[model samples]
Target: MAKLEIVSPVTGSPRDVWASLRCAAEDAARDEPQLASQLNSVILSHDDLSGALSFQIARKLGDSELGAMTVREVALAAMQADPSIVRSAEADLLAVEERDPAIRSMLQPFLYFKGYQALQSWRVAHWLWEQGRDTLAFHFQSRISELFQVDIHPAAKIGSGVFVDHGTGIVIGETAVVGDEVSMLHAVTLGGTGAERGDRHPKIGRGVLLGAGAKVLGNIQIGDYAKVASGSVVLKPVPSGCTVAGVPARLVNCPTEAAPARTMDHTLADVVYDYVI
Candidate 1:
C-alpha cells in the first residue's frame, strides 16, 4: 500500500503539506446566498453528504498499510471543507486512486477495487437530489460516466467492492440492487423491459459480473456468482454459479466457469471532473 503522507497547510513543513488550498477550495454558494440557503434548507443534507463521502474514503482505505493516515482522517479532511469543496476533494481522491498509476502502486485497491469512484459520484448526486437539484446532479453523473466509462445510476443502491471496467455506456436501473464484489463493464444495463410501474428492473445478487452491453430487464433475480456476457438481454432468473449470454439470457455455464476479475485501462489523459457535496 502507498504511504499516507500528512500534507500541511503551509509549505516547507517537515511533514508533507497535507493541508492546502486545494482541500479548502470555496464553493459557488459563498457568493450566492440563495444557493447557500437552498442547500441548507434540506435537513441535515450537508451532514448526510459528509457521511457518504466518509464511507467512500473508508472503502478506499481497505486493508492498506498507511503509516498513520487512516480512512477516518480522510473523512475528517472532507468534513472540514465546505460542501462544495468536499465534492472536488472526493473526486480528486477518486480520480487519483482509480486511474493514477503513480498512486495505484501505493494503494492496494488500485488493482481490485471499484466502489471508490462509484460512491463518490453517488454521494454528489444524492446531495444534489436532496437539495432538489436533480438536473444538475444527473448532469454531473452523466459526465463522470462519459469520461470514466463507468455508468452507475444516481438512484441505484450500490454496495462496496464494485469493479466497473471499460465503464462506457454502463446503465444501472433506478431500482437495481447491487451487492459487494460485483463487476460490470461497458454497455451493461440493469434495466426494465416495459413501462411496469411497481418494482420493475433486475435484482442482482452478490458477487455477480455482467459483461459489456449485457442487459438484464424486468424484476428478475440474477443469483450470486452469476455472469452475463456482452449484449445479452436477460429476462429470467439466472441461477447461482451460472454464466448467461444472448437475448433473454439463459444459463450456459456453471459458476465454476467464472473468470477472474480484471481492471480497466485508465490511460486517457482527459481532465476528469465531478460535482462536490
Candidate 2:
C-alpha cells in the first residue's frame, strides 16, 4: 500500500508486524508501569495478531447478549476459517501507521484506534454475513455502530490497506466496494442515491482518498487514486487520478497523485470554477 510494502520499520507482513508489536508492548510496559497489566493482557498474552485482535474485539463489543468469552470464540472461529482476516488487519494497521500523523506505533492502532478496531470487527461480521449468519452479523453491525459511531453494513466488501481515520460518523452501505490502499476521514458516506437494491452503492477503486464529510452517493465508480475533497457531495463517477469538489462534485483537478491515499493528502489545487456560489 505504501511506497514500501516490506520495508524496515513499516509495511511488513503479519509476522514481522506482530514481532514489532510485541516488542513495542514490552517497551511500553517498562515505560509506563501503570499500564503493564493492560498491555500484558491485550498484547503480551496473545500469540499473534489474530488472537490479540479477537481478544480485543471481544472486550470492546461483548455485552450481556454474548459474554466476552463467547465473542472471542466467534472472532477466533472467523479468523481461523479465513486467515485473510488477520492479513487484512495487518495491512490495515500499516495503513493507519503510514497515513495518520498521530499514530506512534502499530500497538496504538491495535489497542486504541477505533477506526482500526471497528474496521477489523466489521471484517468478522462480514465473514459471518457471507456464511449466511445474518442475525449474528446484524448484531455485530448494531454493536459496532453503537460503540464506534461508525456504521458499516455487513455486506460491504472492503479491501486490505484501507484506512478509516477518525471513524466517527462514517457510513458505508451494503453494496459498497472499497479497494486496497483507500483512505477516508470522518463523516464519509458511501451510500445510494435512493431506496434501491442490488449493487447500488459506490465502487471505490484502489488508492482513493475520500476527504472528511464527503458523501458519495449512487452507484458510482471512483477510479483509482481519485480524491474527493472535504464537504463535497459526489453524485457522478470520478475518473482515475482526478480530484472532485463542491456540492455535486465537479472535476477540479485531473491526473492527480498516483497514490493519493498513501500520501494522505487532500489539498485541492487552486482553480477557477465556472459556476457561481
Candidate 3:
C-alpha cells in the first residue's frame, strides 16, 4: 500500500474514494511486484467502485447454482438500480481506514478485508430482499456466511459509514436495524432471546460502538452514541451516550463519548462494585 495520508470518509464523494483507491493500488503494485497482477485485476482494471465491487463479490460468492458471471450481473443490477449500495461501500471502505489503525490504505480493505466485502455483498443481498427475491437473497446471505464468517440477514437494515472490524462471528438477526457510522467488532451478536416473532432483535442507533463479544438481545434500543463494552450481554435498553458493561449490562458510565463509534474507545470508567460474600 502507498503511504496513507489521512483520507476522509465523510468529506469526499465515491468518485474521490475510487481515485484514491486506484492510486493506492498502483503504488502497492509498484512496491510489491508479486502482487501487481492481483492489484491490477482488482483495482486498476475497474472503471468505478461499483463495477469493482460486483466483480470481486461474484468471484468470491459464485457457486454451482450461480456462476461468477451470473452473480456479477445480479450485483451489478442492484448497484446500478440503487447507487446507494456503492456509495455505502465507499463509506464502509473509508470507515475501516479511518477507524482501524491496522489499515493503512483504502485499497487494502476494498480488495481484501472480509468485513468490508461481507457488508458490500450484504448490500446486494439486501437489495434482493427488498425486491421480494427472498430465495436469491438468502443464497447471497448463505454464501457470505460461508465465505466471510459474517452472517447479517438480508432484512437487517444497516446504515452507511459503519465499521465492522475483524468481521468474524458477527451475527445480525432479521429485523435488526443498525444506524449510520456504527462500529462493531468480532463475535458480536445483535439478536433476540425468545422465539416470539415480529420485530425481534436489537435496534442500534447512530454512532454507537459495540465491543467485541458483545451480545445485545431482544427488540430493545441501543441509543445513539451509546457504548456496549466488550463481552457484555445487554438485555435492556441503553440510554443515549451512556456506556454499559457486564451480564445484563448496566450503566457503567453516563454520557460516555459523544460518538463512541468513531472514537472506538472501549475502556470502562473507574467505579467501585459491591460484592456480597
Candidate 4:
C-alpha cells in the first residue's frame, strides 16, 4: 500500500506531525511507566500518521461486526486513497492544539481526544458516502455515535480546521454545511426546523463559534465570524461578525474579536445580556 502524505494548513508536513507525536509518546511513556505499552502501540509502533491514526481510531470504533484489524485496513485505505483526508486530519490536530488550553501537545489530541477521533472517523465515513457506499457509511456513523455520543449524519459537509469540544450530544443534520475554522461546544445541534426534504439544514460559515447547547434550526445562513451564545435557539440568519443570544436568538452585538472561533470566547457583554428578546 502507498503511504499517506499530509500537508498541514498551519505549519509542517505529515512527517513532522508524526515525529512530534512519536516524541511526545516517548516522553509520556517515560514519565508514566504504566501506560508505556498502550502509548507504544498507539503512537510509537506506527511508522506514519495514517498507520497510527488507523490503529487508534479502529481500536475505538471496532466491534464484533467489524474487527479492529479490518477497520484499520479500511481507514488506512481511505487515507491512502484520499490525500485530503490526511490534510484535514492534520489541520484538525493543529486546531485542537492551538485553541484548547488544556492541550499540552499534538500527541494529546492524537492519542486520547475522542472529539478528534470521532471527527477523523467521520471523515472516512464521509468518504464512503461520497463513493456511493451509504450502508458502510451509516455503519461508521452508528459506531461513532455509540462510541463518542456525537451523532453527525454521514452526508453532512464539514470543513477542515473545525473543532468540536466536549463532543457529546453534538448533532449535524444530513444537509448541514459547517465551514472551516468553526468551533462548537457540546450539545450543539445544526438541525432542520421541520420535515423539509432538500437543503433543510443550516449553513454555518467560517470562523463561527457555537456555544454549548446552541440549536441552529431551519434552512438558514450563519455568517462568517458569527457567535451564537450558549443555549440560544437560532431560527433566522445571523449576520457576519455579530453575536446572537436568547431562546429565539437575537443579535446582541458585533463581537470585538476578528475570529471568535479561534479565541473560543463565550463571554457576552452585560448590555447584551439585558438585550435578550
Q: Which candidate is the best by TM-score?
A: 2
Tens digits of per-residue lDDT for model 3, 1-277: 1122323655553336788888998999999999999888777898888777888999899999899999999999998899888778877887887798887788778878898899999999999999999999999999999999999999999999999998999999999999999999999999989999999999999999999999999999999999999999999898898888888788878878687898798897787231211
Ranking by lDDT: 2, 3, 4, 1
Candidate 4, which segments miss by more than 4 Å at Cα? Answer: 1-15, 273-277
Off by over 4 Å in 3: 1-15, 272-277
- Candidate 2 lDDT, 57-129, residue by residue in tens: 9999999998899999999999989988887887888788788899778888888889999999999999999
TM-score, every prediction: 0.52, 0.94, 0.93, 0.93
Which tens-of-lDDT digit does each residue in 1-277 have in candidate 4? 2443455545555545666778889999999999999998998887878888899989998999999998998898899888788778877887887789998888888877778889999999998899899998999999999999899999999999889897999999999999999999999999998877999999999999999999999889999999999999999898888899898898788654688999999998666633543
lDDT of 1 by residue, 29-147 (tens): 35546655432332123233344345444444334343123544544453554354344433333333333343422122322334345445455555555556678557646655654
lDDT of 2: 0.88
What Cα-based lDDT does every candidate model obtain? 0.52, 0.88, 0.88, 0.87
The window of 10 residues in a row where model 1 has the poorest summed lDDT is 16-25
Model 1 accuracy (lDDT, Cα): 0.52
